[model samples]
Target: MTMTKKHLDSARRTLELEILALQEQLGQLDHQFDQACDLLLGLTGRVIVTGMGKSGHIGNKIAATLASTGTPAFFMHPGEASHGDLGMVTRQDAVLALSNSGETQEVTSLLPLLKRLGIPIISITGAPYSTLAREATLHLNASISREACPLNLAPTSSTTATLALGDALAIALLEARGFGPDDFALSHPGGSLGRRLLLRVADIMHQDQQVPRVLPQASLREALLEITRTGLGFTCVTNEQNQLLGVFTDGDLRRVLDLSLDLHQTRVDQVMTPEGKRVYPEQLAAEAVHVMEENKISALPVVNQQQQLVGALNMHDLLKAGVI
Candidate 1:
């Protein structure tokens, strides 16, 4: 084979080997997985993940995924734990230790201390009968037939299986604990997912005087002034009780002009869109975007349980608020 063809062959072989390793893990999901989930779910404190070398790298990512998904976890390096970081692990927490051979010295050395603390231990190891697995409260088998490396000395396929197993544990615990997108969003407040799930219409809408509104009996000229003053592109038409009747927008103005109707002689109610689409203050801002996209309308009036106007928002407001 040419040099370029040789490189392509190696890449494909590596991926195929990793794929087979993950496929092997699928059938190994058994009762031990359930016990692992149960142990994590019952914990009042965080899930502490610890490992050495490549295993440690995978453990850090696993902890991050767990924390962001609502499981509440952090990674602890085994070498650090041996030094003084052992103080961070409490009896209320569960320890997830990763070691492909189950004989990693830095990790195994901390086992006796973990046992003395009465803390539960969960092991992710390739060797089911290794020392770490035997010492664990529960063991998850992340065994693969061989490493993707041609020499089978590097930690390639083994680390991938370990990472996948960790993800499986985190997701299972997330579902069992009734964790939802809103809960996940709270933990990730600075992210776009959080904005989509937690941002509400009340948080972004213009209220009170900022809302352009006119009485149903008002002339079209008066309503136009309200829309211009508030710059919301539309004005709400309400009755004396402040209940919404309809909306009049720039589009309505254009259509009326096309008909050669006298703007000064028109009543606001005569051309307003009565019972137009409305949203509640408590609805998600993302939902507001969905409504706007579906209706091809730029603005929506907010009403409360009593059907009285409380606020107003448009596509521009949502875009500026990052809900779009």
Candidate 2:
């Protein structure tokens, strides 16, 4: 086979082996899994994860996932823990240890100290009877038939199984604790998901003089000037009291142009879309995206509870705010 073909075969074989390892893990789940979840749920403190080498990397990711999903957790490097980092763990915290063979020196060495603190130990290991597993308060089996590595010397299927099991534990805990999207958004406020969940129309809309609006009795030429000045592509037609009456957009101008009406003489109210699709200031920016999408419009007039025009927004505004 060509070198490229040989590489593809190796990759495929590796993936197949890892997939089988995950499938094997599905059968290993027992009441111990439920017990582990119960222990974590009852904890008034954080979940402290620790491991060495490949296991350490997986432990870090698992810790992050657990913390972000509502269960507070952090990764503690086993080697560092033996020095002075052990001070970070308190009796209120539980230890989630990872060791493929369940006997890594760095991880196993901390078991006694953790035990002395009366901390609960949850271990994920390939060997169910290994030192770490046996000493653990609760053990999770992450065993695989063999490594996906051709020589069976490198960590492959084993690491994949351990990571998958960690994810399973986190999601199970997330559901049991009744964690929802809003709670998740609070933890991830800097991300796009948080923006979609937390940002309101009032937060991003152009308001005050920045809002493109004109009186209904104003000439279409005057409304066009407002739209051009504000650069929002649309202008709201409002009454003297600032209540929204209608909206005139680029699309409406195109249609009006087809009739060759005089822009300076025609009233904006006569040509505007009467009581067009609108959004409220307090509505979610994501909801504004939905309304604009459903109505096939690019801009919307923001209204208050009394139907007063308060702000204006367009798809471009949502795009800039990362709501798109």
Candidate 3:
């Protein structure tokens, strides 16, 4: 085989091994997994994850996943726990220890102190009979038939299985806790998901003086001027009571131009899309996006419960807010 072909084969073999390892883990799930989730769910304090070496990296990610999903968690370095960091642990907290061998010295060494504190320990290990597993309050078997590493000496299929197990635990807990998108958005406010779930139309729309609007009797030329002045690409046509009568957009202008309508003589409402698609100020900006996409429109006039035009927003505004 060519060098490139050899490389591809190695990669494929590694993935296949990891896939089988995950399958084994899936079959290993039992009451122990259920009891572990119950313990985590009932905890009054945080989940403190600890490990050594490669296991430590996996532990850090598991802690973060647990934290972001709903269960409060943080990674604690086992070596540091031996050096006074054990003080961070309280009886209210639970320990999640990781060790493929089930006997990493740094991690196993902390088990005694954790037990003395009356803290519950949940261990994920390849060796079911190892010291850490035997000492744990609940043990999860992350065993794999062999490492994906060709020599079977390095951590490969083992870590993949452990990570998958960690994710399974996190998601199961998330579902049990009834964690929903809004709750997730609270923890991820800076991300696009948060913007989609949390952002409201009122938060991004132009209001009052900034809103481009013209009286229904206003000439098409005047509406065009209003659209230009606000740069919102559209203007709302309303009456004396400020009730929305219609909306005229650049596309409407194109069609009107095609008809060769006299812009200065034509009433704004005569050329407007009567009672055009509208959105409420309190509605999610994501919902507004759906309306725009479904109707093939670029802008929406924000209205109140009484159907009075309150504000306006365009596709550009939603795009700028990262809700697009």
lDDT per residue for candidate 2 within 1-324, as digits (tens), equals 999999999999999999999999999999999999999999999999999999999999999999999999999999999899999998899999999999999999998888988999999999999999999999999999999999998999999999999999999999999999779888989978889988999999998899999998899889889989999889999998999999999999999999999999999999999999999988889999999999899999999989999999999999999998
**Clashing pairs in model 3?**
none
**Alpha-carbon deviation at 104 in model 2, angstroms:** 1.4
Can you write out model 1's per-residue Cα lDDT over 1-324, one digit (the tens) per residue? 899999999999999999999999998889999999988888999999999999999999999999988888999999989789998988899999999999999999999998998999999999999999999999999999999999999999999999999989888888887898788778878867778889999999999999999998788889889999999999999999999999999999888889888778889899999889999999999999999999999999999988899999999998888887
Residue 202 of model 2, lDDT score: 93
Weakest 10 consecutive residues of candidate 3 by summed lDDT:
108-117
lDDT of each candidate versus the true structure: 0.93, 0.95, 0.95
10 residues in a row with least lDDT, candidate 2: 181-190
TM-score of each: 0.90, 0.92, 0.94
Angstrom error at residue 229, model 2: 2.0
Whose TM-score is higher: candidate 1's or candidate 3's? 3
